[model samples]
Target: MRFDSVPMPTAVQARPRDSRGYPVPAITPWEGAEPQFALTDYGRSADCARGRLCSVCNELMPRGPVWRVVGGTESAAIAEALEAGRPYRNLAPTMEGPGHRACMLYASMVCPYLARPNARRGRTADGESELTSHLVRGTARGGRGAVVGFADYEFAITATQVLFRFLDVVEFLPHADADEHLGDLEAELARRQPR
Candidate 1:
C-alpha cells in the first residue's frame, strides 16, 4: 500500500524521524545513541503508561477512545468466548499501551515493519536476525497487523512491555481493512515519491 499521498497527522509529524524519514516511535529507545526499533525504553514506556502518552509519538492523548496494534490469536477472553460458543463484546489485554488514533493509523500504513508483511522486526548489532519476545516479533503467524481501539484501558507495567487491558471496544480494523488502506496509501506515496 502507498502512504506518501496522505497528509501526515500533526502528532505523527511531531515524532522523531529516521534518516530515511520514517517516524521513530516514542516507545523506541533513544538516549543520544542510534534508535533501536526492536527495543522499548523503560522510562519512556512508564511515562506513556502513567502520563497518557501515545505509544507511537509520545504525545498526550485525550482521555477517551485510544487505539492499540494487536497481534495474532487475540486475547484469552476472546479465545474463551469462541470456545464456549458465546459472542464476545469486549477486547482483552494487549502487550502495548494505547496511542493516538492518527499516529496508529499512520504507523499502520507506512512503518516498514508494521506495514510490510515480510519485513524484519529487528536486526542485531551485527545485522543478524534478532527475535526476542512475541511483542517484537509481532504476530505469531507473521502476518499483517490490526488496529483495535478502546474507550478506556487498564495497564500493568513490565520490564519488557506495558500490558493494557482494554475496557470498551471502540474500533477494530483487521488486517484486510488495513491492507485496503495501505493500498490507497501506497498509491499516494508513489505519486509523491519522485519529487
Candidate 2:
C-alpha cells in the first residue's frame, strides 16, 4: 500500500518550473522505451500531473487500484499465468501505469490481441504475432497517482485483476491458460509450439 521503494522526485528536482511558476513538461519514468500502445490521448497526464490522468480514460488514473496492460517478455509469462488460472504474486513486472477499471475493461474487450482469438493467433509479415499481451493491476508506490519506474512496483494477482505493490521485483516465466472463455487460445498455442 505504501510505496517506500523509490522516493518521489521533489518538485524542483523532477518537475522544474519556468519564470511564471507553471510546471514544465513531465518526463515518463520509461526514458529508454515507450509503451507501444496508446489507449488514451491524455495518458501523459499521469506523467505530467503525476496522477491526474488515466491511461485508459485519459482522465486521472485515480488513487486506488489501477489496471495497466503489460508488454515485453514478461507479458508472455503473465498472459500464460492468466490463461492457466494460476496465482501470480510478488512478480514486479514492468508496466506503463494505471487506468480506470471501466476503461481497462473496455480495452480488454476491444483490443485485438487481448480479446480476439484470431488476432492473437494471426502472424504478422515476419510470421510472428509481434505482440505480447498482459493485463496487470497496480497502486501508487507511495502517493495517490502514478510511479516513476518499474523498480518502484510490486505485483499481485486476483480472480478479477492483478494488483501491484509500490515497489518490488521478481522473475518472469511462461504460464498456461485454463479458462474456457479464452476461446481457442489453448489450441492456438498448441499450433504455435515447435514440434
- Which candidate leads the pack in lDDT? 1
lDDT of 2 by residue, 1-195 (tens): 111221222221234443433222232222233332322123353242354454444444434454443333345544455578774432443333444433333333334343332334232111112121333222111111111122333433333232334332232222121122123322433453568
Q: Write the per-residue lDDT of candidate 1 for residues 82-117, one digit (tens) a residue.
A: 568765554444446788776676777666555555
lDDT of 2 at 174: 20
Poorest lDDT segment (10 consecutive residues) of candidate 1: 124-133
- Number of clashes in every candidate structure? 10, 13
Q: How displaced is residue 36 in candidate 2, in Å?
A: 8.0
TM-score of 2: 0.34
State each model's CA lDDT, in order.
0.64, 0.33
Which ten contiguous residues of candidate 2 have the minimum total lDDT?
Answer: 139-148
Q: What C-alpha root-mean-square deviation, in Å, does candidate 2 show against the real structure?
A: 18.4
lDDT of 2: 0.33
